[model samples]
Structures are given as structure tokens and as C-alpha cells.
Target chain A: MTLQDYLPCLYALLACAGFAVMFEIKKPMFILLASATGMVSWLVFLLLHDIGSEVARYFLATMVAALFAETFARLMKAPATIFLVIGIVPLVPGGGLYYAMDALIGGNYALFAERGLDTAAFAAAIAAGVSVVTSIVRMAMTGRMNRRERETKKEE
Target chain B: MRAKQVERCLNFCCETGRQLIKNGAEIYRVEEAAKRMLSAFGYSDAEVFAIPSCIIINIHDGERNFTKNVRILRTGSNFDRLDSLNALSRKVAAKELSIEAAEAELHEIMGRKGYPAWISYLGYGFAAFFFTLFWGGHALDAAIAFFCGLLVKAAMGQMVRLKANVFFIHICASMLLVTVPVLLTALGVHIIHTDKIVIGAIMLLVPGIAITNVMRDVIIGDFITAVSKLAEVLIIALAIAIGIAIPFGILRALTGVM
Candidate 1:
């Protein structure tokens, strides 16, 4: 969409890129991928319609980003973490954590606890979803395709 | 051309070894091998470096089997400087690098710079305003709590001294540190809204934000680096917590705030 709405993601990408460059990481593609993820995330956030749309958009963007990272790792013969860290920086639950900590200190114990749980759940969902998606994709590429044939195959 | 790079590596290793020797690291020809590796990685001007305890642990833990007599320094160069040596090396040459020494040396490096004054001030300011505004704290109590937060973070950094255990140390230390100091202020021993003040003061001690970011980055799979940086951040958080928690706890019981 407009450049303004995308500023946070752009800022996130630049920050990720700056840090990666600072560390002298050799992988340039990761920086590009991270920058792209920010834009892609924003775009997905916009195009989708209603109901579970927000969650669906996040899932799709995350999956695409994760798949790209996983696939990039396979092609480059490098560790996937390099791709993951940069790509995910914007997704870090900063606002959530800040709220949780704030609620915690303010003595709104229930809100505090709930926010913390929410943050953890969000974090776990991201981690597990990416891992499972990437692993399943990898398995499919191994030429093991076929549920019916696989039933006979397992029996055999 | 390649050999010239190797020559640079060799030069760096020898030079680095000399520095360690001068510093009393009980090291041998580590500089030489490091130089070789540096050259292979394309550093033509990396003349010196210090070691990090992380590598030492890896060495001692049998993860790596470099000769015992020689102590090696571990460095993760970004090649950012190397690529621009012909252009930017002169500019960056004056910047402090990430190269470090074994535990004592690393600690010394951290200790020497001390906490940046601005960071401390921010912690203090946040402690005062945030505690009073959010936690209904009073002025004097907030001030005390804020100072306690600063003190807690500092103490943790100085006293904990536990190598890899730093993360957990930081977590517990920070949690208790923030909670307790303000508790002192709360009990009205010195100030009532102090716990809020202390927590705000040492909020920097909690690397939760940084660690979450690190994990998020890793979860996304852009792992070219940031792993070590995350570790460093975690340590800083731990130091903050340790610095605050002890005093708060003591004050709590002493003030009857328990």
C-alpha cells in the first residue's frame, strides 16, 4: 500500500539489515529476504477480506517467509537460522511484551498474566508452524508422495 | 595475491599472540593459527584480537580440540571492515571491535566502559516517572527505587560471574531485583512506591525484549548471526537483575515489607 503504513516493516528490515551487516554475515540473501518479508507481511495484511482474515494473512506471510528461508537454506548449503533471525525480527512481540510488563508492574495481575500467556502462545505458534511447514515441504520433495500407495508401502 | 593474504594472517596471529602474552593470558601460538584462519577468511590487516570465554568453554568442554598449550581467541569478524579496507578501514579502525578475551578479560572489558551514563540515566528517569505514574509511587520512594534498579543491574554484572549460567541468572535476578527494591519503598521503610521505581530503573536488565527478538529472528531463519549478540544482551539483563534483587530483598525483610 502506501509507504507510510509500511514504514514499521521497512524500519524493521533496515534495522535487521544494519545489524546483519554489522556482524559481517556473508549471506546477502537473508537481508533481502528479511526486507521482503516486511513488505510481504504488510501486503498480506491489506489484501485479505474478513473473519479469520487477519490470522490467515499472518499465517500465509509467515509460511511464505518460512518456506523461502528453508528453501534458500537448501539452495545455499547454509544453516537456516541465518535466514530465520533476520526475517522474524519485526514479528517479535515487542508491543505485547511491553504491555505485559506494564500490566505486571501496575498490579493488574490478571491482565498481566493473560498478556504473558498470549505472547508465549504467539511465539510458540510461530516457531512450531514454521518448523512443521518446512519439514512437511521437505518430506514431500523426497518423492514419497502418495497416501494410498503409502498405505501399501507401509504394510510392505 | 593469495599468499600475501596468508602472510597478513600470519602477521596477525603473531601479533595477537604477543598482546595476549603481554596481558598474562597463559597463551601460546594461538595468534599464529588465528592469523591463518583470518587470512583464509580474507583478512589482510587483522593484526590482533582477544579471545572470548565462550570459545574457551567450547575448547575445555571438548567441543573443539585445539592443542592445550595454546589458548586461542575466538572472533566473528563481519568481513564488513575487510571489504572496505581500501576505503573505510581508516574510518572504522578506531572503533572498538567485538573481539574479546576469556572470562576475566571479557568482564574487564565490560567493567571498564562501565554502564554508559545515558543508559543509567534513562533507567533512573524511567524508574522515577514510570513508578509514580503507573504504580502510584511517591517522589522519594521512586528515587530510591530507581537508584536501587541501577545498583541491582550493576551488581549483577559485577558479582554473578557464572559463565553460561548468566541467562538464567539474569532472569531470576532481574525478576526478583525489580520486584524487591520497590517493595522496600512500598513498605515505607525508605519509600513505599519503590518496587515500581526499582523495576523501571532496571528494566534494561531484562533482556526479554532482545531475547524475544533474537528468537523471533532465529525462528524466521535468518541465522547469519545475532546468536552471539543475543548472548551478550542476555548477560547484560542478568547483570541488571543481580544488581537490583539483592538490595531489594535485604531491604524488604529489614523494613518489615515482607
Candidate 2:
């Protein structure tokens, strides 16, 4: 990949780190990890966008970010939202949402509808991606607990 | 006397849940944490219900059941408080902390100051700069966005201090964001893509945390909290859109340029 391809990832890292600071994420290590998560997710999104539909690109990127956030939360002994918020920053459709509003205000109905739908689609894709990963993790956790309980009963 | 003791335990549990919800903890997590803490304190029949804006905790101590309701008026996310509160709950669940000790620790965490105002202001500038770059803006656009971010942050801080409503604050911030770049371009400076600069600066107001929590809450079947938070997100988005639209519309009409 060209150096230009790496620029987005670098910017994502800086943006996430800035957000971590603004949100008062006290630990420097957490901030660094969160920023790295953002960078990886943005990189993945950029890579996938070249080959997939916009919705699929967002879904895959969000899944990667959410899984990373969940793993980091477990390893760091903190809430997953802390990491997830920063990780998904690079993927959130902030620009599209702004453009949708801009179009509406400028009386361009066609552009408004287009941008609005795009923004909504991206939001839905992000939600679906996070939900899928979270459910899988939850199921795994419960299954492990159930197996442990069954083993204890057998031992008794 | 026994009734008084049950009341105290219920109050403590409810207060803990309230703090969690106020600090933007998910509904399921808040309820689970409060329940675990109460059970550890010997209130084995305790039930905790939490939403984005309110928490209701019920504790039964054989002869009498106590239900306490706490209304959360304001909500913001601070990961440090979330971590400490989660740790405090774990300690309680492990039977390592008494009710009084837990209360004391919670108070200390509440009183702890976050990073100073200046650091967050600097964060606005940095976020604007990087987001501009991410949006494919050149170095000049990033620089302009950085200054615009500082201006927006200062304006927001002033509005907050004046106790202005959040919707109005958003409107004003967006207006300032678009107006700054527009005026700069009019002043003979070659700004490449003012739209990217506006987008980067607007990132400061996007409800990222609320959206994330809303999805998680929906997956966990906390529909009440999820729906309410979704409404909040939509309102904020609408406010932001209105904010941006009004200024650009007025400017286009006045100057015959967009």
C-alpha cells in the first residue's frame, strides 16, 4: 500500500487518542490501546471498502472494532464501552449525517434523502455488527459457565 | 431497628446504581452490579432495575421490603468513574467491602476531578486536526480545522457556563463551524474543501457513546433504556443538522455563494 493509504489510520489513531483525553480516560495505557484499536478498525474499513458495499464495509469494520474492544476490556478489567466508543470513532458516519442536514437546509431534497439514507444505513450496519459480536461472546461465556456447573455437580 | 438497617442497605444499593447510570453505564450492567452488591450485603432478595435516566432498587429483608427510586437528571460518560465503580462492585461481591466502606469509596470517586478543562480544549483541537486529515483534507484544511475547533470549544464552554440548553449549544457550535470556514474562504484564503473542515469539527458533538450504548442495550434486551437513548441520539442529530443548515442557508442567500 502507498503511504497515502496509511494516512487515514494515523489520523484515526490521533483522533481516538484525542477523544480518550477529552473523555478523561485516566490511564495512559488504556488511551494508547484505544487509539490502536481505532487505527486498526479504520485500516480494516479502508481495506474492505475497496471490495464491498458500503454497508458491508461498515459492518465488518464495526465487528472488528467491537471484538477488539471486548477483548481489551477483559484484559484491562474495565468496561467495554470505554474502548468501544473510541474504537468506532473512525467508522461513525459523522460526515454523512452532516451532509444530509446540509442538503436539507439547502433545499436539495434528492441529496438530502440520499445522504440521510446512507447515514442511517451506516448506523444500522454498525449496530448489527456490534450486536453480532456481543451475542457470540455472551453465548460463549454462558456455555462455559454451564459446563463448569455441570462438572461441579458430577464431582459432587 | 432491623427495619432501619434494611432501609440503609436499600439506600446504599440504590445510590450505587444511580451513580452508575449517571456515569453512562449500560442498564444491564448497572442492574447486575447493584444486585450483586446487595446480595453480598445479605439482601439476597434484592432486585435492581436501571434505565438511562432512572434507577429503581427493591430489597426484601424477610419482614419488610424496601424500594428506592433514584432519578438521574444528568448523564455523561467518564471511563475512570465507570472503572472504579465496577471495581467497587466486584469488591462488594467478594465480601471484601462493608456498606460504609463502599459508600466512602464511592464518595471519593465522585469527588475526584477529571482532566482539567484546558486538556479537553486541546483535545478538541487535536480531534479536529486529525479528523480533517482522515476526511482527506490537506494540511491547510487541518490547520484551519484546528483553530475552528478551539473556537467551537470556547464557545461551547461559554454557553455551558451560561446554562444554555444543549440543543441551542449545538446549534450555535455548528453555525460557528460553518461560518468560520465560509468567512475564511471569502477573505481570499485558498481553503481546500471547507466541507471536510466542517465535518471534522462537528465530530466533537456526535453522540458516539450514546449510539454504542443504545446498540448494546438493545442486544441485551433493555429496550426501555435503548429506546430512550435512541430518542436522545436522534434529537441531538437533529439539533446538529439544524445548526449547520441555518447558517449555511443564510450565508448562501446573503452572499449568493455556498
Candidate 3:
């Protein structure tokens, strides 16, 4: 990762760590977790995918975030949602949403659609990355969740 | 998948939300603690809501219901701003000290100027601008995106009525609200302002909040609530995206990007 890419990752890590503190993270646990997320994310960008493309880089980084969240949640015995919430920040389709709105406000339909599509894709990726990983993990743990929730509901 | 989490509390227990300030109890901690106290007293069966500003309780008996404002008070803690202010607020709310007495002490704490919370908001807002600036969008556009996040949270204050965890509310509201704007923006109806204003303001809405809660809960080993809150936040964001996109698409087809 060039200094530029590394810089964003650094910011993302700091943001994640800041979140840990802001939300009252316990001592020292979040340091290693967030570091792992940043390290893994960079590795994914560098080795797993083509960083030549901006969108691709973002997509991979976000996926790595999801993976990090899933792994952390599993290891720590917490919900993966923390990773979802924090990781989604840097990758949030903020630009897509904003540019899309700008295009709309400016009465530029094509620009709006293009940006809007980009936003939806990112949003979905976030949702899917979180929901899919957590569910898969949980499914592995409690194979009885689906049928159990239903039977439990019936008894209620 | 069920987004809005509502479960019966042990009683109207005030959750004294504490921040890791390394020294006295922070605002969140004090509020949470007071709520638990009120809940135990039966003045409330459920903590209606609590913030740095005010807390509302579900008056279980509905008899001794007195006031409904977020009143600040002070205490003689023999020390700094946080302690004295929190002590005063707690004592008054719990009725250990009368409002008049608390008010007298508050004079000193209120004199201190500046708040640190806005700094975090500013950080998130700037982050939004950077996130969006690369998309060939301008500064104002990013500002709108950030604030859009705030608006979503404020709006959700009325929409989803959970009170235990403000972090959960923030995440849920942000993801849900952003989904529509993002989708609509994608669809070419971006009528909002800056990514900063639109998205940054709502950074408060992002589930980054739940990270700490989830971590603490995991560390303290309260996995059930942690997982439940996490799942709810994610699902809500997904739902919000659907809420914005489907309607946006239909509207676009009918009237074009208006």
C-alpha cells in the first residue's frame, strides 16, 4: 500500500479505535482487534484483489472489514455488529449518496443514477457482508436456531 | 432480523451509562445509573430514555408523575466539573436532594465553557467529506452526506422508541436513513446537500457505537443482549435501504428525478 492507501487505512484504524473509546471500550482488547482489521484489510487489498481500481479497492477493504468483524465477534463471543457499525463508516456510500443528491439537485439525471447505483451496491455489500458472515457463524454454532425459534414461538 | 428490540426490563431500572473518563463518572454512566435507581424505586417500570441532557421514565403507577424536563443540577463534590454536576443531577432526580439545593451548586459547574462531544462530531463530519470527495464530488456535497446521517438519527428518535442503548439507536437510524438517500442519490434524485452535512451529521447514526457496547458486553460476557442489539442494527440498516430504494425507483419512473 502506498502512503496514500496506507493513510486512509490509518484513518480507518484510528476511527475504529476512537469508536472503541467513544462507546466505552474496555482496556486493550480493541487495540489488537482493530489492528488485525487494518492489517487484514491491507493484505486483502494487496494480495487478494486488484487495487488498480478505486471501486475494487473500496469493495475489498469493506469485505475485509466484514470478515474482521465476523472473526472478532466469533472470537470474543460478542455480536459482529460492532465491526459492522464501525467498519461501515469509512466505506459508507457517503460520496455516492452525496453526489447522487447533488446530481438530483442540479437536475442531472444520469450522474444521479450512476452515483445512486454505486451507493446501493456499497450499502448492500455492507449489509450482506455482516448478515451473511454472522449468520453463517451462528448457523454453525446453533444448528437448532431456525427450528428452535419456530418451535419456541409456537409454545409461546 | 426483527429490528426493533423491545423486551421487558427487570423493572424501571435506570442504566447509569458511564464513560471511560479514567476519573469520575461520565455523563452516560450517571444517566444510566440514575435510571436504574428510578426503576428500582418504582417511579418508573421502564427507563423511557436517557441522554446527557434528560431522562424520561415510564411511570408505572402514573401517580407521582411530576416534571418532564431535562434539568441540570450541581453538587458539592469538593472537586471538578463532572463529579459535582453529576452528583447534583442524581441527587435531585432521585429526590435525595431538592431541586433548589442542587441548583445552588450547579452555578459553579455551568460556568465552565466548551464541550468535547462536538469534536467527535466534527471528526466524523470531516471523515464524510473525505469519503465522498474522491467520487468527484465537492465539499458541500460531503457536508450534506454527513448531516444527512444526523437528520436520520433525529428523525429516528421519533420512529424507533428503544431507550436502553443510544448506540443501538444511532446505528439503526443511520443505516436505515442512509439507505434511502444513498439509493435515491444513486437513482439520480440526489436532492440533499453535502456529503458532510448529509452523511457526516449522521455519523452519529452509524453502528460504530455498538462496537464498544458489543466489546464490553463480550468482555463482561453479556452475549445475548450484545448479539441481539447487533443483529437489530444490521437488519434495520438493510430495511432502511429497501425503504428508500423501492419507493425511489417507482417515483423516478412516474415523475422523473423531481
Candidate 4:
């Protein structure tokens, strides 16, 4: 692919930075890092566009974003939602939601059903991706804590 | 601890949860933070439950059962406040701050102000501009979307100041979002695509992130929160759709084309 194909990732990064501003993220370093996650995930989505199905691409992209958010949250000692919310903005299916509504308003039930379900599926895919990664992170954290506690108890 | 001290600690914990929820902390985080603070205060048996709009804390300190419920009417996404709040809770959990200090810090966090309105408006404008290009819009469409984004933010700010309903505010903002692009296209802005402009500007109102996070609640076994948050997202989406349709409906009636 030509350089033109990568432009969307750049735009996604800038859009995420704008969202980061609106979300009131204070630190410039955190904003840049968070927005960079968006760019990276969008790039991942685009790279797999041809080979992967629509739902799979969104799911995998969201997983990457969630992973980045989790890593950043741990390092920065901030809430992961800050990064996840901004990073996933460009991936949100606004067009699908709008088209579904447009179809419903225009009295096209078939199109409405198609677009609405497509949007829901995509949203579900993203949700599943986030949930899976968050669950893994939570489990890993708990395991580490439990191991530490056990070691301390043994020493005592 | 005395009953009065227990009561005060409960209040502090409840207030912390309220702040967390109000500033857009996840349901699990709110519950966990509240529990940690309660335990740190030597009330390990305390139980905390929180949904999107409410938090309930219960403690049985030998003699009596004490419970406090905080009703959160609205939630706003302010990551700055959330970050500080999280840090404050961590300090409190580590016993680094006493009740008085923690309360003072909570007060400070509660009173913290966001960025000026103009900066957020610029943020909206630039976000829309970039999103339009991300969606493959021409430079002209992106330019128009920037202004539409600014106008949307300004309109929403005014409506919020007037205490209008959230759904009404979105409907109005979205109607304004569509009207600008369509009006521009009608007024010989041949280079602009209304669809691209609308798609980009609509991001400001969409609940996509909420829907994504709601699933986390479900995964965390907070079914009540998940369902309630999902309902809220659906309602917001419907409001945005209705907002979008109004302009097209008006245009169709006025000139028979949209």
C-alpha cells in the first residue's frame, strides 16, 4: 500500500488528541502517549483489513488499545478509562449508528435492521475485546498480590 | 471506633465513591476504592456496591448496622479529576492520610475546574476536522466540520448552562450539527460532502465508549450496572438519531430533497 493508506492513522491520532483535550487529560506527556495508542490500534486495524473480517478487526484493534491503556494506567497510576476512552474514539462506529437511524427514519426496516445489527455487533466485538483484556489484567494482578501475601505469611 | 467516628468514616467513604462515580470511574473501581478506604480505616467488614447512578456502603461495627447510599444524578467524564481521585484513594488506603486530610483533598478535587470553554470548543473543532479526514473526507469537508464541531460545543455549553435535559441537549446539538453541513452544501459549497461532515461531527454526541465500557461491568459481574449503562447508551444513541433525522425531515418538507 502507498503512503496514502497510512494517512488515516495520522488523522486518528490527531482526533484522539482532540478528544483527550475534551476529556480534560492534564498532562501533555500522557495525552501524547494515549493518543499514540489510538494511532497504533488504527494502524493495526488497517493492516489487517484485507485479511480479517470486520468484527475480528474491530475486536483485535480494541484488544490492542485496551492492552495499551492497561499498561499506561499501571505505569502512570491513573485510571485506564482515560486512555481507552480517547484511544477508541476513531474506531467507534458513528457512521453505522447514524446510518441505522437514517434507515429507520426513512421507513426502510430492512436497511435499519442490517445497519443496526452491524453496529451492535461491532460494538459488541469492541466490548468483548476490552473485557477480555481487562479480565486478564485483573487476574494477573490478583495472582501477584496473592503470591506476595503468601510469601509474607511464610516468612512470618 | 465510636459511633460518631464510624458515621464520619462512612460518610467519607460514601463521598469518595460518589466522587469516583461522578467523575467517570468504572463501577468496579468505585466499589474497590471505597472498600479499600473502608478497610484502611479499620472497618474491614464493610461492603460497597455501586452502579452508574448510585453507590451503597454498608458497615456492621458490632453494635449496629450503618449504611449510606449516595445518589449520583449525573456523571461527567473528567479524567484529570479521576486521576487525582484515584491517587487520593490510594494514599488513604495506605494510611498515608487521615480522615481530615483526605476530606480536605476530596473537597479540593470536587472543586477542581476543567479547562476553559474555548479550549474544549477548539478541541471539538479540531477533533471533528481530523475525524472527517480520517473518514476520507476532502479538505473542504474537514474545514467545514471544524466549524460545525465548534458550533456544536458552544451550543451544548449554552444548553448545559440552562440546565436542559441531556437528551434534549444532544438532540439540539446534533440538529445543529447536520443543519450546518446541509445548509452549506445547499448554499453552493459544491466541494463539501454533508455525509462526511455529519459523520465526523456526530462523534461528539455518540455513546460508543459507554457501550464498550458497559460490557466490562457485565464481565465484572455487575449486571445491574451493565444493564443500566447499556440502557443509557441506547437512549443517547436514539436521541442522536432523532436529532439527525429532524434536519433531513425539515429539508425534505421545505424543498423536497435532502
lDDT of 1 by residue, B139-192 (tens): 665556555545554555455554435556555555654655455446556525
C-alpha lDDT score of every prediction, in listed order:
0.44, 0.86, 0.47, 0.88
Residue-wise C-alpha lDDT for candidate 2, range B1-258, written one tens digit per residue: 888877877887788788877776888998888888888889877878788777888887786668889998877778888888888888998899888898899889989998888898888899999999999898899998888888888998899889887678888888898788877777767646888998988898888889999988998898998999999898888888887887777777878876
Query: What is the DockQ score of candidate 1, to 2 decimals?
Result: 0.07
Error of 4 at B166 (Å): 2.3
TM-score of chain B taken alone, every candidate: 0.40, 0.94, 0.38, 0.95
The CAPRI quality class of candidate 2 comes to high
By DockQ, the better pick of 2 and 4 is 2
Tens digits of per-residue lDDT for model 4, B1-258: 499889999999999888888778889889999999999999999989888888889998987999999899877878889899999999999999999999999999889889897899889999999999999899989998999999898998889789898789889999999999878766776777888999998998876457766967777888888888888898888788889998888777777765
Clashing residue pairs for model 2:
none
What ranking emerges by DockQ with the best candidate at the front? 2, 4, 3, 1
Clashes of each: 32, 0, 56, 0
Candidate 3 i-RMS: 9.2
What fraction of the genuine interface contacts, i.e. the true contacts, does candidate 2 reproduce? 0.81
Top DockQ hit? 2
Error of 4 at B173 (Å): 1.3
Taking all chains together, the TM-score of candidate 3 against the true structure is 0.42
State how far residue A41 of model 2 sits from its true place (Å).
0.9
| Predicted structure with the largest lDDT when compared to the true one | 4
lDDT of 1 at B100: 26
